[model samples]
Target: SVEELRKLLSDKDAYENYLHSIEEVKQLDTLRNDLRKRNVTLARHNLGKESEMAELRNQCMIIRTTELATAQEKFLDAQRREKEILARSSPASILNKLQEAANAADDESESLHRKLLSGELKVPEFLQKYRQQRVLYHRRTLLRLAA
Candidate 1:
């Protein structure tokens, strides 16, 4: 009787356990696939955001560079006008002094021009320095706009 009862119980328990194992494996496989799909989607979203951010950063730099260039150009124009006034101030009869000052300005301007043309100075920094120098010239001299 004991042996018969043991055989029946074992038969019932084995089949039920095997069925449960099969169901659990199927559920696990489905969960794995779902997680993988979500991971792929998240990765794509993050990459898109990164590229957009990079594009926006580049645009911002371009705008800032353009604004700085504009400010520098205005300052240089003012300086040139002031220099012209200074040149005109020397008595018309004293051409020699005016010529000498003009020559010096030309030499310094040429040196800076060469550096700019050669790409030795970063454009934005060069422009900023030029603006500062122009401001200094304005403050120091009796120069005024010529026209």
Candidate 2:
């Protein structure tokens, strides 16, 4: 109202204070709106960054799974080759191992006998161990006969 404006104008101090307060409120509102806009922009940028991070993570997992599968295949192939190589060894090698086992059993039997003679082992224990060694020695000899 023009008349109301004139009344406020009659008091210069009141009019000026009221105008200054209104200007301050308008500036504050503008600042709040700008801040809100900036917040929205930052949220959009963060969403884009999150999607990029997820893509990179997926790529890394794909690479890792492929590499692990390749490694597993190589490991299995090496194991198969090792088994084949061992199986291909000559019969002479098998005969030598059987003969060595027989000799070791004979030596263990002799040691047990000596322990029995020296009274270091009980007669029952010596008999059991000596019987076991003799059986092992005969079994190894039978295995070598086939070789």
Candidate 3:
């Protein structure tokens, strides 16, 4: 009988301490569940963002391979064309062309005179065309000399 009575009187604050502990444990469990839900939501959002980033990276690679490569090739072709044009536009080449043009103009005037004498060309037409060809020859000669 005395053992039972001593157990009943063992610590007057035990009941109050147990109740407080239970409340604290309930609050902690609720907080843990809320944190778990938040973590799941954040993980899903992170996964979505990572997938979007990967897709964007893939598109960039496609553009780099196709569009950028095409543009680079076009640029190279343009550079080659420019080099060819520059080569053909050298001073010596320009001077030679002017001399050839003068010769051609002189030959054309001679042909017109021959045609006039042969009666293949009318007098007024022959005069006009011959004068134009002679003027062109003189102009080409002047240009060739200047060059």
The candidate scoring highest on lDDT is 2
Cα lDDT tens digits, model 2, 33-136, are 99999999999999979989999999999999999999999999999999887865768777888899999999999999999999999999999999999999
* Window of ten residues with lowest summed lDDT in model 2: 85-94
Query: How many residue pairs clash in all the candidates, one count each?
Result: 0, 0, 0
- Model 2 scores a TM of 0.42
Best by TM-score: 3
Question: What is the TM-score ranking, best to worst?
Answer: 3, 2, 1
For 31-98, candidate 3 gives per-residue lDDT tens digits of: 99999999999999999899899999999999889998999999999999999998889988898888
Tell me the spans in candidate 3 whose CA falls farther than 4 Å from its real position: 1-29, 44-56, 63-97, 116-128
Candidate 1 per-residue lDDT, tens place, 1-147, comes to 777566657899865565557977779878999999999999999998998999999999999999999999999999999988887676652455544555555555556667888998777876776566545544333232231
* lDDT sort, best first: 2, 3, 1
TM-score on alpha carbons, each prediction: 0.32, 0.42, 0.50
Candidate 2 Cα errors over 4 Å, as ranges: 1-88
Q: In model 1, which regions exceed 4 Å deviation? A: 1-46, 91-147
